[model samples]
Target: MGGQDRESDAWVYVVNSGVLLDDAFASLTLKRKLERGRVSPENLPPSIVGRVAKADGPTVEAALEAAAAAAPVWGAYPLETRLDKVGELLCRRLTERAEEITRILVAEGHPVVLARWQVSGMLECFGPESLGFYRSQMHQEFRHGERRIQVRRCPDGVVCVNPPQNAPLSSALLGVTSIMAGNALVVRAPRSAPLGVMYVLHEVVRPVLEEVGAPPGTLNVVCGDPVPLLSAWVESPHVDDIMYFGSSENGVRFQERCLTAGKKPILELAGNDVVVVWKDADPELAAEALTESFYGSGQLCMIPNQVVVHPDIADALIASLVRQVGHIRPGRPEEEDVLLTPVLRNEKFFGCLRDALDKGAELACGGHAMQADESRDTAGIFLEPTVVVVRGLEGARDIDAVRHETFFPLLPLIVAERAPDEVLLERFVAYVNSNEYGLRNSVWATSSTVVDTFLSQVRSGGLLKINDSHIGFLPYLPTHGGTGLTGGVFGEANYPILRTSHLQGVSISPGSRPREAVFGAWNALLPTKVPTAFPTTFPTKRSQEF
Candidate 1:
């Protein structure tokens, strides 16, 4: 492999007619500059990059043609082969380039720690334990003597992936698992942050694909405006399914379009996740978990958007949270341990705060916007990790912060009204369950009964975190996806390998007679003789059951 700088390499990847197409399709010059080891406001790759992309919106049709030609061949390969190639070989390559990938991610405005966290999450998803679990779920069989019944997940031919701009690299990593599900994939990398993702694909993943003897056009990577690229996928007969990530409002509308075009839509949309703190909860642990709301300046869809605290512990919990918020100051992305990114919607942050304050709410700490170096300023790019205390649940959802998914570092803590344990617990769980959007919900509780109650009743989101890190990734747990607006009609805990595939049942029966098999369920009730021994010929009319 040539040692070309990935940030400046040909960003678009296309192959057609069994031949590679590496020519420049779109010259995306999303250039930035590093000032004193810190990423500047420009974001994305550094100044060395000339053009950012190679593929144009219209050129995506060639990707579809290439993917279609490769789907059957790629899907027919054994699942184990696919897993070994991606889960092992590709995993190794990524590990070798972990430092590089993290640098690129950090340069693209992801904080250093968050960049590493993203890379680690991708690795864990491809780890043996997780891959093994996926293998187990991919197929299951039950045998009855020589006859067998099998339930299995099969790849849905060609799949298209549209990763979100906020987390392009990680989403691209997940999208590649379509190959593990035996699909040929076309990845439409987010134009806002395509370089790092395209770099990983070309440098790490494509090499592994070649090593595994995968056919040409098995995976296509392109970059352009999502509107046209998505339309291209929706209109194409060669495309089978689309795994899309975007805001819930736009995504649900796009889901309708995909359906109208007779294509399956797999959505990863916005999350209005909740965190509940009961009286029996640990304040320190709850504060730490709640800090996830400020990660990536709270633009991340999976992080907690609002909090619900029992009135018994609201004061103490709010104090602890305020102290913790003091430590979450804004800084440049490449700075050590910085979590905040430059938020574009400072007005929305203030708007939510103002609405909350107008409607009987109080700001505990960190409400105003700040600059990259953490100074208070009106026109600063970063919104301080702000926490608003909303007293009581009555009419709380009417507030925009409580009802909607605010893509800022503003957290609304609903202080439950004073009540008995039974009433408070019941209402709190009901509130979380009734949220319009659900990706994740976390609870910090020490009492066994309280924990069990919340777990049993709050059943809307995809994943439930009990006294654990809400944003942390676990080996087998789904790291992305949820129900309601977070995922369209077919949304649940997303394992991309399974999401891009469809379930099918296979049955095998040998040497079975048609008429005998028909009445096999009632064989014991039949007179010990054969049907031929039924006196003379059977009645002219057959039984209604038959």
Candidate 2:
């Protein structure tokens, strides 16, 4: 009803006072308005707003200055103490506000149930399990002569986080880990998905930041277009590290900018993940796993884009998948198990679907768009759980639909001849290993050997699962990123304790030992220790021995 007028309005949030202010980006309202129905069919949700005032540049600079000034004090905090106070408090607050947060997510187009789970996962990211992971990597000890040397963990100061629009809260969780590692952060949340992030920051993180005596500006969340904020942050000499999530193209560009500015960047970019089903794979299990391949409308970075199935069971697997997919009902955000959000329901996304159909891809099941509710007449961005049987991966011209990360729901199945189980598995492993995107991979196999081979040989993905659950991540697993374009660096496991800090090697010498004492342990184990003395010093002894 208010769609037309709302499309012309924009909301911005900037930091002022000691807390987040709603009118931070008010000036930008004239430049670009926040469109309610422009993306989703919902009304403008309540959130913190920032005004694009020219003088506001100093605010961001001040925030960074505060974070940098506070870094040493925050970084020196005991890991256990920080985990107990800040990490534990954040988790508890999230649990307390779970329902309220889920409703905001639903308002933003995410299904209610899935929204709750998303919050749950965020909470678990700060829980004991994640804390244990940090603890394991925090301290190292080794014996030296009569004393022991200890290696301690250190935090990288002043981290800047730019979360993706698809999963703002979850992506924000990735940034929270920097705090656990004792690094202060400045976060730029997606303008389209600010409500969920604001809710989490206000209800969960703000209190923790205060209670833990975290320095002012240690954790700041600004809501606006990320381009300006990121450019400013990256160019600034104060900002130490930046953690980003977005398209590969943008990621590469961001990396170049950071390098040009002489800054450090950790990018988590796009993915064209693949799933390989061998001849021995069970059809039923493969069907179940297919849900993950298309969940969140296949919008998640780890969601599989292509399925390479053995030709023998390809038909049966497609049939079973079709049946299960049929049960994947699209409904209003209030409905249960309605995972997809009705954003980006435009020609760009649907055009890819149409192009794929025109290119000789056989639709195994869903091919048309569906409405969230018949009465509303306002359609959700729903694409049927499309299963296209292509002769080969090369047959589909809309490869961008399956190859690049399209934040939409589309499933494509590719068939390959069944060969020796070993050879087939090997080929599948090699294909996954060779992929440019390395976020996550799923394999549905009955053979332990097949699973082992995949796990050992598949070098691309950050996480690999066998005959197991997909999409749903545990606290212990690093859920955020991977190698290649996925992050340009390996290891995006969601444990904040690990994500927030860097592995620092510190040697505490009880007494200043000879430099060789550090390398003596290894040298002692060798069959013949390389003589430290120079040839000239041991000339007589060497001559006699020779």
Candidate 3:
């Protein structure tokens, strides 16, 4: 999904008490602009942007209350039963409604192909087989000679889901797995990209939720200013967990609130992912991986924000990247041929590019802003796919381009001038780790030793892709979350089904040995033992006797 212009509408959806309510007391206006640079009014669609009604505090509270009331019943249900019945049905609905959802995404400025891909990904994640790993992770049985212990995980009582504005459908789709783990959820539709997410939840998933005999309040969707809704969830005593996806600035603050309220927060915050290219790495492959920086206009959390390359291959890698970038076409997101979307922040893009260049970095290619024309004419939304090269670390680290994350299509490449040595490797690794945001990082190297060192030494992102694309979402593996600023306090790969729950240890004592042991320990602690029917053999030898 992408940003769009906002227009007012009368539609309001609040899923509460197992029903979809249309009580929109307050409203939020969002925009969806198709043509950039003040497109001729005649060419634009009549209603590209629209507004969504907001849920009041009491309404949100009611939703949470209902969810709390239903949590026990849902949480007690069998995991496999929920996955097979609810998950499978939701997956089918997503597939059936894929085209409709894709159309909505396209209308919101997502590319036709990319929109389809997004829906496809959502389907994959919703598929029954996708959550099979959590079955074993959530439940385990063990036994010894005399003791039988069953170590299993149970869902957090109630989860309040606040997915990111970008890719809301896929992100909120994670709540399904939470349900599969037997937890009730209240998912907030993305304020910016609610159309697709709303369609999936209301049209596809809601029906199955009701049909499967999922208790009322098991699932709720509220649309409004996130501040109040989140506060309500935090204040609610019954809410057990909050899954948040957004910037570190807001996320850190929310995490604090969650901690203060004694609620678990599963955060998927910002990422300034880094990529390292060793001297022996394939320039073409490195370029391919780094090119992902342009994906989603570089707005993605997993996009490669910075590249650290050996000087020997830095020039070659830059050349390959420039060549690859030349093929990128910026146009309407609904077009099949367009690879780059209009950048939302033109000033920030140019400002970052200017700062990098002023700091002794060279613009390898496509750094300047492009003028709007008939074919490509989106103002403030279209930036040339840019690649900036920093020959050394002197002025690079202080520059905003390298130091901070700009959600624009800009890739900053830093050159390690020194040869590969323990000292240089250590310095480079430190540099990569210095990035405050850690979501995912990668190393492009042919040498097993270099790869191993990079893996073992670089302690940055939650995920380390040896040679894979930095932005691809591998559903089977953990894709969201990271360390440092990416996830607060508790940072790791976010597996919602597992992370939204806690482990519970159950021990079954087959004999009365435990009772006897407790009695003996109590008797030893007490000077006078009450009359209890328990046989205790005195030790044959004591220290004094010996």
Taking every candidate in turn, the Cα RMSD to the unseen true structure, in Å, is 7.1, 7.7, 8.2
User: Looking at candidate 2, what is the lDDT of residue 414?
Assistant: 79
Q: In terms of TM-score, which candidate is stronger, 1 or 3?
A: 1
Models 1 onward score TM values of 0.88, 0.83, 0.84
lDDT of 1 by residue, 362-444 (tens): 88888887776788889777788998889889899989999999988989999998989998888988899899988999998
Candidate 3 lDDT: 0.74
Give residue 200's error in model 2 in angstroms: 1.6
TM-score, candidate 2, is: 0.83
Q: Using TM-score, give the best candidate's number.
A: 1
382-488 in candidate 3: lDDT tens per residue?
67788888887656778888877788888999997675466667777888788798888898988887888887888777888988877665656676779889988
How far residue 65's Cα lies from its native spot in candidate 1, in Å, is 0.5
lDDT string, candidate 2, 105-156, tens digits: 7766677777876887787777788767666777778876666667767787
Q: Score candidate 2 by lDDT.
A: 0.68
Model 1 worst lDDT window (10 residues): 15-24
Which residue runs of candidate 3 sit more than 4 Å off their true CA positions? 1-53, 127-129, 371-380, 515-546
